[model samples]
Target: MLPALLRRLPRRHRASFFRRRMGAPGDLRRFLAIIMMIGCVFLLYMFWAQPTSPTSVPLQTFVPVVTSKDSNTHYAKIDFRWTWTCENKRCVRKESTETGVHVSLTTCSMLCGSSMLWPQPTGPTTLGSHSVSFDREQLTFETTATEPARSYIQYSFAMFNSNVANLIQLQKNEPSATPQRDFNKFIVKVFVEHSDIVKLTLSTDESYKLILRMEGENMIGTVTANNFFGARHGLETLSQLIWWDEFASGAGSLKIVKGASVQDAPKFAYRGLMIDTARNFLPVESLKRVLVGMAANKLNVFHWHVSDSQSFPLVLPSVPQLAKYGSYSPDMVYTASEVKDLVEYARLRGIRVVIEVDVPAHVGNGWTWGPAEGLGELVMCVNVQPWSLYCGEPPCGQINPDNPHVYDVLEKIYRDIIELTGESEIFHIGGDEVNLECWQQFRNRTNPYVDLFDVWGNFTVEALKRVTKANGGKRPKHVMIWSSNLTKRPYLTKFLNKTEVLIQAWGGSDWTETPELVSSGYNVIISHVDAWYLDCGYGRWRENGGAACDPYRPWQTVYMHRPWNGDPVYRKSVLGAEACLWTEQADHVSLDTRLWPRAAAFAERVWSDVGTKSIYKQEQLSIEDVYARIQMQRERMIKRGLKNEALWPQWCSQNPGMCL
Candidate 1:
């Protein structure tokens, strides 16, 4: 009907008719006039009679837009802008600025509180407003009876430090002044709902959930965990999310990007790192630092290679003479108290201490333990004897299998170690590289009563039984051994129970032994030497003229390692992987450089998805993008007192994407 009426009337007449009928002119000019009048009323109401509705406006637009002072300037400037929303109609904006701020608890508290604007309700119909402020560095908020309180929770920086001291201790190298400020303080808000005894159990779901929303003045963040261990991990991740910007405000500040959320747990139960302290004695303090590094990466197992042919640095109370004779020096041995301290420290970081006593084959140093103990001639000297009489390797050794006293000594050693490192369910009985010559001598001594293979099989079986029997009754939850036993001597399986042992597959990359061990129903931890060994490339330890292992194992190689790439059925038997650092030439000076960044790569490989895209990949991220992230983490570690090797030139690290 309207179309017919418009068609019957002229264009000029149609406008007048519609205006008369609708009580307003339908022309664009008249319509615009009405809108202008409404806008004027709104502007007047917003400028004069501000409503009680509360709103927030970023301070960037306010005058005197107090820019952040240069970081090195020792003074802080804060600018705040707040909006008062009135009845969903008008909003009043207010600004405040504080310059030349000093660093003090009282000052910080005042600055935090002063950002808020208290709104006053003008009329009886207006809603009640809030008057919020902070005192004593604590945020205090109060709302009127008509308004529901919106709590502005302010957590003490000291409280945050205490909550994550285990992690903070990693940052011991950080400057003493405002150390917490090294990382963004607002990235994570940790809340513990219940105070339960936090024991580091082997539960995969030691529940933790983190949520981050990047769409505000401050990125709102929350971390919820069932236990303290999970909370520690969440905080580490929050730290990882933070990026330090040197130019952000002159000196430097940590910044967290807008949106991210991660609910993480170890996919495999035994993400680990093996540090060989026996080959070249590492200081107790250095080992503790390594544990801190491992915790930072969320790697839980510290596979301590405590003893080897080169040295027996672990001081056992039952066999005190071992350290006296076997250790490189008196100062190098780990005392009982120190061992306990290290174990406790690891436990607090959710790391389990697994001691590796590489036996029989690597027991050349055991001969020095003492002749009275009958360990003096445990194995023939590899270098001093006829090749056929000792072992395959140049430096060969083995505990005399024919001696009954050997088993007795083994039991004592195992019992003492188990007692000292409390709650260790897995003990590594190093059964790798037991040359045929050593067993042949045992066969010759026994005179056909037992063959060479039989001697080796018997020794391994007896060692497992002794270690297990010492730990209460049943076999230890797991006994880790090198892959050579399962691969080279398949006959040993006749006397072995697959469930009681964990095969550490450190066979060089070319060796295809991991799958067979896994298929045979033994759980495995892949430490594939060619790929994950950090001690490689420096040179083989005992080789003449320092034989080099060629190219060093870079972080990329460690990151590319996939422990369960073959035989899906056997994948379940694959417990996890570890990066083994044999400290043949390493000492305190080179320890951090040898392990870090590269070890960190292994940590990410074990913690994150196998197929996570790499920055170096084509059409993906630029090299600098990934390099910067890793470098940043490395710098954080260095600040925490870890001496890390530089990944690239300083210019490349400082300028992201510029290296490419």
Candidate 2:
């Protein structure tokens, strides 16, 4: 058909028609050819410039820059809502409508809304409604401290450097955490008033003021403190203020309050948490984790119940036989360097490692090497049959104070503790739960005229003297002794001196001992077993287990425990408190769960003494409000690599008001 048409046309016309039909002539053809040539060049250049992998593609192609109209709606009123929710049994992002359990796009972040912070920072404090977003990479810590304080400042800075990326809960694609074309820097300027101070003591001021403001190009965070210790607390508070905003700029990112102020100080100087490593030795890593958790809550004291009847994991070179014979195994021992390193680790985090070697009573397994090396009866009735007859629990052992050599052993132990921890100002002489029957048996058989009570009282006196001698002949400013028979009434007067001893009450708030100890002018650390003991509540460990301190002390019990709720004069004897976690039924496997959330409750009780509507106003907030704060803290701990137990069901957290 085409040939017939072509034949019908003239030869000259046919050639012209062919060119026009097949390609187009002159300028029209030139335009089409130029377009194709440009397309080919673009394809070739793209292939050459880009690697084989497709990752180099700009983020803008997928995520458009969210302007005022396109910004993610975090709440109906505010630009952002910073609540939280549960995920994988820990608090992850409180969940946006899509990724979390909000169940709808309207659930505002209520987790940090009222509480805003944990361990409830004491007032004058205020939380604002506006928000500011930033790249955590820009987070910087600059300190005005000099010399020794600078060491701690650097340590805290390094910790943030190694950890700021993890502060936000990043996930697959984690696009929000990616480098952004639009993000601001955050600078933390710390002004320490006492820059020359570096020591961490019970009396050390852990008070700090944190002021946050949005400057021209960066979010300026100012921390003013009396020393490095307080400055470190301010850092922890700063970390708390930043959170993952799942609904930021239509893409999840980290955001902090644009304006905020916190003038905070621990209510008590002796805010502490005690972990017994004797029953079960915790490795350096585990103890470091403890320090991290303590730092998070502003707890300053690490009362290391280092050795007890079960084991003496601390290897003292002067008394090598203690660890050789007493440790669960040689491999499970804490060497001198390990102790020093751990002490430094705690110190850097603003925590004092107060080493405690429980004296006469809890001194069994660790002292069995006496006669083997010419030290006569260093410990009495070690692992004796019918253990309850001698000590409070199994594997009965007690230091034989009757033996003159025992004082020498105690002195060496004290000396090593002071050297290893560099903590000679305070010490815990574990003198709790002594079985008078054990002493009665030994003394009655030996000298019948010696009163068993007097022997116990005399043992206490001798131990303190040895400790004073060990501490360069200067008595510790505050010597800690557990609540025990010897600490009651006439015995207390005969053995312990009020000027020197700080009694740690561990019986129960209901007991008269708490009041009696304070009334007697002995500075007391309230650790009532019913309130502050974290190791209780797990039924029983033995075949016939039900201990006196059972039914588990929950976070509420800890929060409301104020044994010193009296006049200022009576309270004068009430030095802070320590939450005790005896590892009889707890170990590394359940360490975090046992202490946290609850220990944090104890922390607030002793730190701010406020778990209310407002730390400053001290308004009446419900237990539900307190629970919410704990939940937030628990999640923060999880993000920081702590394995805390669940505060409530995920359902309870997701639907906060409904659960209550």
- Among these predictions, the greatest TM-score belongs to 2
What TM-scores do the predictions have?
0.68, 0.82
Residue 597 of model 1, lDDT score: 81
Q: Local distance difference test, per candidate?
A: 0.61, 0.77
- Please, what are the lDDT tens digits per residue for candidate 2 over residues 215-248? 8877888988889988888888887777765555
lDDT of 1 by residue, 26-96 (tens): 56567688989999999998888754322242222212221232222122223423322222221222232
Worst-scoring 10-residue span by lDDT in model 1: 115-124
Clashing pairs in 1: 51-86, 52-86, 53-85, 53-86, 71-250, 71-251, 171-640, 214-258
- Name the lDDT of candidate 2: 0.77
Task: Report the poorest 10 consecutive residues by lDDT, candidate 2.
Answer: 98-107
